[model samples]
Target: MGANAAAFASLLRGATNLSQCRWILEQLINSRYAGDIFLGNLALQMFGKLHGIGDARALFHRMAQTGRNLFSWSIMISALCRDGHHREALGCYHAMNLEGGIEADMVILSTVIGVCSALQNLCEGRKLHDRVAGCGLESDTVVHNALVSMYVKCGCLDDARAVFDATPTREKDAVSWNVMMAAYSSRGKFQQALEIFNDCLLHSVQGPDAVSFVTAISACCGLKDVKQARALEELSCSHGFLETSVAVQNSLINLYGKCASLSEARLVFDRIASKTALSVRAAVMEVMLRREEKFCHRFVIAFMLPSILMWCLGLVF
Candidate 1:
């Protein structure tokens, strides 16, 4: 690639506007590098970001008419997956495998695993897991993470935990811990989630990120353990998680309300810098309804008029 082609490719990569992307794509097509596979893949990526799925599919088919490389197949498959066309993405993945020349790599496997996770297709997920092992890519942390996540989504917690246990400690990141906690929490296994979360805190390899705290706190909410929830609130606040993450604050509010600690819930609500996205208002109403039943009506009239309006407008419960 020349300076001009390189610059154009960079432009495509950075482009956020669909119109500009189309114009730049047209320029590339009329230029000397029109037949370049890299440039074609770049166009496909730009189209994918634009959510122009039809255009992206057309581009992929056009590219395949001449030939399709591994990157080309991966891009198309990933684009389809991003566009919420999992069936097509799976079809493309299988088709790529049948194409005979190109072999699926870790990147492709990761993307396909995500598709399986989204679709919750355990059978296909197992096949892909086997393929990852057979290709000797099972040691890859990212691919292993994807495989674990897929099994978790498929409701195979045992399989997910097996993979989690087998993965080297160095290979396990915050995502690995979060996935296991989420799997347990989703299945109403809050005790297991909290245990994994404690282990996460103890090991501190990748350290606990916002999702880690939020997931564990959510598990605490499910269990309604006021003491543990309060401790998590302290940990989250001490870590500056509350300052940076609205989701953490929201989770804290919900946790407090669930634990019948209405004062702490109100404190969290008040501490939130921006309350636009939180469900704290509902948490307030819930606390009032459950714990302050005698004053619930008066509280709604005095302090929850916005919530009343939201209810009238069908925007809230």
Candidate 2:
């Protein structure tokens, strides 16, 4: 019976027919293994993926009658968070704590911390940080990464930096480096972000990925440093980052525009296969406006006006 329930849940995962999924789940609920914990959690995951959070919440309340396990609690919390119910997710976390038998694991801790981050609940986040330490789960790299992200989100870069510094060498993955760099970049600390990018090069066991390059290029845009931006662009290409990442290409265009290199910006812009038309257009126009008056007028008449007219026509008709 349990096997049948799991199989049904697995089938529901790939199921596109919402009505059929409902029918199948109803069949399972009427079966002998309806109380199976694994089936209940798997059903929650399927429902969340299908945007049936209302149904998932209903199922959660029913399951809570018999008492939910830790995994069940985590899934509900995660589902609530993914659906943008941050306060509800936090409330669920507290409820899980007060419910008593089940302890918080890394996944739950990470989810609640993320909720706190999104809500910017610093006092609650700090208390949770102490709870994490007391639970001896602070050494978990996943939880550590979450704490770094949470602190950064709450605008406590000092606290974020402290967490990053404490991360063991073995556990400092690319995300850890990326999050730290992002924290600095988000605050307009471009030089500090670049410095961290450089540190990633020197220290991280795993090399920078597309996200890393994009963040660093964004920092270059903020600095408006043409020389360093060009160097970074070259470095990204050499690492093959530009070959697959459209975001890196877009950032290259913005970086060159910010540095007043219209020609170079156009070169990068032309290379993007799937361009975001309006944003690219805006960047091009900003660079054109900075050029000598004669060139600017000629370029605007020859290029910008037509593109704008075309975009407006597409929207209208």
Candidate 3:
């Protein structure tokens, strides 16, 4: 019966029919589970993917009645996020604090961090982060990466940096390195990001991704590292990064312009593939053209952002 439940859950994963997944979960509940913890957790995962949070929650509660386990708790909390029930999920985390005599493992903490990010509850995420550290699960790389990403996405670059700094040197994978670069570049700290780029070059084991390159170029734009930015732009092409992505060229345009090289920016813009690219290039270009005229007239502190404000300028001028 337990094997059947797991196989049914596996089958449910491939089916997009939420109703069918819920039905299978119901079938599992109607029949005696006989303390089959694995099948219970598997059912929880299937319902989560199908967005069947109500049924998943019910099953999780049933599991608790039958000498509940950690897997059941994590699964239910994760499924609860389908409708943005982050706060409820956090409550679940606290409720199960002593009942099961189990603290949140990596999976549980990751789900809570994700919830915290959705709620923009950075303070809560930090408190949980401290818990992860105090509990000695800080050595877990997956949790470390998740914490960094959650902090970065929530616009708490400082917290992201603190997490990055605390990451053990041995566990710093490419994802961890990229997260650190992103945390710095996100807040316009391009100089520090560039130095990280140099550090990445020194590490023979680490190979940065296109996302990493984009972050480095973004840092260049902030620091007006036109020369180094230009070098990276050329290197991207020479290394055959396929220049297929509009984001890559867009970064080039922004970096060149920030380096005070409008002409080079134009060259980069002209080379962009017209297909599969969003209209943001046109929007950015409009703003860049306006900045050309106002470079001597106004402080224009918010160059790229000023493009939206230029729509009002267009109506006036």
Candidate 4:
């Protein structure tokens, strides 16, 4: 029976679609292994992955009747969040707390804090923050990052910065720097955003990724500092992001356009093999609105007419 349960568990892991999962689950039930905690957790995860939330909830209730474990509760809460049921996800966490015996781990805490971030429930997020301290998980990097993100999304930059500063230097990852930079940029604190960017380059263990470059370029665009924008362009190029990431390329085009560097903007736009409508619009709008020279307007119109038509035809999305 143990060998059969292991084979069924393996099959559950490999199941791709809802149909396969349901069939395997039926097999487990017939084999009298459906109530097994480990197999039940696997089924719960598969149902969640396949968007079978209703099935997941049903299975969760059955597991609860027989006594659900931490993994069971965590899977259900995460599934609820993924399906955009943030309120329900919080409710699940609360129910887990009421049931006792299961200590909240980093995975569950991070997920529930993210639910608060999504809902912008600052009050609940604070409660969770207190809970993190109570459970002695404040030093966990994953939970700390989630707390920072929650505070940022809630429009509490001071709180976010406090958590960010408290995060151990070696534990800080790309997400930590990117979220802080983006928060400052979104709030029009462009200088602060750039400061965070510079710090990330100096201190982050894994260094910056595409998002860091985009956010920093956006801050330069806000300041209209052409020299800084050019420096970032060069840095992005050195990082090989300019040629690889469409988001970084698009941000550069917009940055140069806003800085009134039409030639630089056009150069970046011309390099994109798969230009988005944003890139096309950014390039053409700058040319049409800024350049008073009739010949330049005509040249832009002629050069961009094909892409404009493609955009109109819904082909260049």
Candidate 5:
């Protein structure tokens, strides 16, 4: 019976007939079945992935009535989270409290933190933070990272930094570092954010992946450092996805203009190659032209790049 459960779990992953799979589950229900706990939990998970919350919820309720274990609880919480029913998911957590004897681990804590962020329930989220500390999981790096992101999402920058600083100075993972950097970047503390980027590299957590570069380039734009920003753009080129993000391209143009390197700025601008690219280009030129206006006698705005015509006509935005 356990082997049959395992086979069902695996076959369910393939393009099997849904009606056939439903019939098997029905058979398991009727015949004094000895289904594997792992397989039942797998069904709960697979339903979430294949259908939606409606499907996962039905399977979850079935698992609960059969007196399944904590894995069932985690699966249900995760399914609710992925389906964006964050408030309801948090409600499930509270209702299940003192009932399942389930100890929330890093996976559950991280998912719950995301749910809080999605629901924008900062107060309940903070209460969960206290619960994490009470459980002595505060020092766990994954939990700490989740807390920092939760604070960031809630617009509590000060609290985010407080939790980040409280992290033990031991080696931090890239996830931890990235979340802190993202928080600071969001608040326009780009210099401090870039420092975190450096620390990310130094700690060997990771070397500038595309997302990391995008975040770091954001900081560079705030600092108006074209040279360093261009270097990041070049590094991202090595990742084989020649498709640069619009954010990256826009930031590069701004940095170059701020640094007064109009030639480099024009080069980056031309590569954008899109109609909507005009606004970011306009914004960059607007910022630069506004600055260069002080020297209006010395510089002219027209005839820099081919797209200067488009920049002139206000089509980019």
Candidate 6:
């Protein structure tokens, strides 16, 4: 029985689609090992991977009748959340808690926190924050980042900053810095955003990525500090983002356009190897709106040419 159960579990893991998975489950039921906890959880994971949430939920209900474990709950909740069923995910989480034996671990905690972030449920998010504290997972960097993102999305900057500051520096990843920087930038706290960007460079081992540069450049744009924006342009070049990231290029174009440095903006726009509609629109809008006397003809040529070409190619949907 043990060897047969293991073989069925292996078959389930290798199953690539719903039909294959169902065959394995049928084999398990016929073999009278369908109730095995490990096999049951493995089946749930495969169902989730196959985007079979409906099937997974049915299996979960059956497993619950016999008994479910931590892995069972985690897989179900994660699958539901992945499918954008945030409310349903929360419902499963509450059921798991009421079940009253399986302790919530970091995996479920982070996931549920993110569900709250997606739903923007600040009240539920705050309750989960306390649960994290109770579980002694407040020091976990991933959980801390999730909490920060939740608060920021909920418009709770103070709470986000509190979590960000509490995170140990050694554990802070690029995500940690980017989320905080973006929060401040979006709130019009440009100087604070730039301060965080500088601190990220000086302190974080992970340093910055393209997103960090984008946010910082946006802050410089908000302040209209051409000097600082130029410095950031250089930094972006040094970090190898200027050549690779279209987002960084777009932000620079907007920054230079806002600063009335049309030449520099044109330079960035001209260098894009593959110009997206956004890049073209940014250049066109900035030129037409910022220095119409200088680039009015250029805007008509730049914007209309590509748009006409896209329409011809049936790509303008």
lDDT of each: 0.84, 0.82, 0.72, 0.88, 0.69, 0.90
Q: Which stretches of candidate 3 lie over 4 Å from their true place?
A: 1-7, 32-35, 120-123, 150-159, 242-244, 260-262, 266-276, 279-317
**RMSD (Å) per prediction:** 4.7, 4.0, 7.8, 3.7, 6.8, 3.6
What does candidate 5's lDDT look like per residue over 1-317, in tens digits?
46766566666565244465566566656644434566667666776665457766777677766766777778888888878788788877776676757777767877788788787779988988998889888768878887888889999989988888777756356677778888888889998998888776666434555567668877786788876867766765665322556655665566666666766665665566552444345545645585655332222333235457767779756
Tell me how far candidate 2 lies from the true structure as C-alpha RMSD in angstroms: 4.0
Off by over 4 Å in 2: 1-3, 266-283, 292-317
Q: Which model scores highest in lDDT?
A: 6
TM for every model, in the order presented, reads 0.83, 0.83, 0.75, 0.88, 0.73, 0.87
Worst 10 residues of 3 by lDDT: 295-304
Which candidate has the top score in TM-score? 4
lDDT of 3 at 151: 89
Give candidate 6 misplaced runs (Cα > 4 Å).
1-7, 14-16, 270-278, 291-317
Candidate 4 runs further than 4 Å off: 270-278, 292-317
> Residue 212 in model 1: shift from native, Å?
1.4
Cα lDDT of model 4 by residue, 198-253, tens digit: 99988888999999999999998899999998899899989999999988998988
Model 3, 179-296: lDDT tens digits are 7887787777767888777777566265666776777887887788677977888866865552665666677766776777866765665565552223245335534664665432
Worst 10 residues of 6 by lDDT: 291-300
Candidate 2 residue pairs in backbone clash: none
How does model 2 fare in lDDT? 0.82
The TM-score of predicted model 4 comes to 0.88
Point out the higher-scoring one by TM-score: 2 or 6: 6
Pairs that collide in candidate 5 are 278-316, 278-317, 279-316, 279-317
- Displacement of residue 260 (Cα, Å) in model 3 is 4.5
Positional deviation of residue 210's Cα in model 6 after best superposition, in angstroms? 0.7
